[model samples]
Target: MSHIPYVPASTRYDEIPYRHCGTSGLQLPVIALGLWHNFGDDRPFQTQRDIVRRAFDRGIFHFDLANNYGPPAGSAEENFGRILAKDLAPFRHEIIISTKAGWNMWDGPHGFGGSRKYLLTSLDESLQRLGTDHVDIFYHHRPDPDTPVEESMLALHHAVTSGKALYAGISSYSAEATKEAAAIMRDLGTPLAIHQPSYSMLNRWIEEGTPSLLEAAQEEGMGVIGFSAMAQGMLTDKYLGGIPDDSRLASGKVNKDFFTDEALGHVRALNDIAAERGQSLAQMAVAWVLRDQGASLTTALIGASSTSQIDEAVGAAQNLTFTPAELAAIDEHAVDSGINQWWGVTASR
Candidate 1:
């Protein structure tokens, strides 16, 4: 099938809210599109293209990806590259494209980790696959327990100074690591841009303050972006009644055991609050993340399986404010669902 000529919505910017990135002049939409799952080789290219188009039409300008974000790995960037070439190339300057280096990409020792070799080489590969001169934000995907933080941060500095990436970020780094990494970037004069972590109403780790990682970023003037804001469908309406036969949670990375009766009870309670707010449960979940941004978070990095899901998430900006009573009610049910797909992937290693 031939691709249709894309025309963006005229009211694109009306409902979306943009916030400053810490003290940096750079600003990002309250919600960012994360190509973590759907934009891969396994999915239809046109669907991927449509989702990107709809997201931009809804005022989302940030497209976040990592080097290894696909079933076969690296397919997300390659696929998005085609979409960019065919459709979004003309609007490149209007988008904030970011890709991370770290995580497994190629074989051998140099293919992964936070070392200078892996980070820089992987970024070049990401740029090649992204079909761009430079990404708006480049991140060292995670802390390298094996490599020194200074070494990893220096490569991020090199990425910015070399003009391959305009800004720098980190993901899944703990409070101590965030402070150390931010200091390294500050000393190098790159200055940390943002930090991505697995956060949602279900996980509640950020709220737990194991040490308050976002607090560290705030003091250092770096921004926060929360990923997995829906808890892999737990915080959404899908599991409120009970996991549907076709639910993604029925069989996926998330163990079925985590979706306990108690967890569903929480989801049901939350859904009632969302209904009272005149929004879907997923919208409420995303908005709750943005509500604490700048105060504790910056952007909610959302991943969607369908374009309508993106539309629903964008609609979240319509009603972000929560009453003290609503928040207190939320606190009543936002217990740890005991499932973190992110940690399930990384923590064991």
Candidate 2:
């Protein structure tokens, strides 16, 4: 049998600096690897294994997963669970593992949403799928209008209090909802640890009220991690030319009907700004999201299909410095296409 690629025991773990998530004491790599697309059932197991190994070698200590990330739903977790059983189990203590449950899972009402039953059951299934006793962070995937906010927070609070999760967070919640949830979680004594929201060069909706939300989180010693920091690869050079064959846009998972001529034109303009910054579109995009000068902004949740693509994205950390003039130029040219209206901060606006 071919030997597993030699993962050097002395792999430099200091390549990527660990930043605290929000105000919490838990530290994560500045860039975290997410298994949203590439860890599915259709993908090769070896390829996925390599990606996870490479990430750990490079000091990306955080791995983000969700219950419904795979095409068959729950497949990503199962696949990751296998990796954990074989390779990651030895290093589990050194890693920060996170998972979420907010979107639809099965056909019925019990399969999804942020209800107490769904949250509890989903976590159990996710734990089984991930083959882990406890996750570093468990998040409510999205806001649930049908359930009372207290119910959702209590479920998350229960996860931490019971030792199922070390910390808790809420993903894609409105600034108002985040405040309410944080207050309740604080009251429960578990306290919210982080807030995961979509923030990118193209999407600035979170900025509308995120500052205040962040301020409160800091007061409570929680952290904030931004996802969709690259706007689903829209801010990358991969789309500069007509949608390439290997790009995610070409993948059947992404609906092509939405990317009309207008969206393409907008992408072209944003690419020009990247060129001016002397950075790849993806690099510039990640840097844009990490612009919180003194405040403790934790990490960026980035997804990649291939090892090379992730390498390019992680290269963004090298050029985190941005001048005021560059920031202004980016704001002037980078405009959202209203594609993310469903995002909590922009849903009503």
The candidate that achieves the highest lDDT relative to the unseen native structure: 1
RMSD of 1: 2.7
Which candidate wins on TM-score?
1
Write model 1 residue lDDT over 1-349, tens digit each, in one string. 9867777788877759988888898999999999988888988998998899989999998999999998668999999899899988988988999999788888899989888999999999889998999999998887777888888888999999999999999888877777777887898999998888888888866554544776777888988889989888787877776668766666474678887888888888999999999999999999998885446567898988789998999999888898889999998997787776444112112
Query: Across residues 1-349, which tens digit of lDDT does each residue of candidate 2 receive?
Result: 9746345246537666668766567888888888888899889998998888777777787999999988689999999998888788878898899999989998898787778999988999999999888999999998878788888888999999889999999888777777778888888988888888777766766666545555655665777788888777777777667788877778765656646677677777767877887888888888778776555468888987777766776677877888888877777766776656346631121
- Worst 10-residue lDDT window, candidate 2: 340-349
TM-score list, all predictions: 0.93, 0.92
Cα RMSD (angstroms) for every candidate in the order listed: 2.7, 2.6
| Candidate 2 positional error at 115, Å | 1.3
**lDDT, residue 272, model 2:** 80
Ten contiguous residues with the weakest lDDT in model 1: 340-349
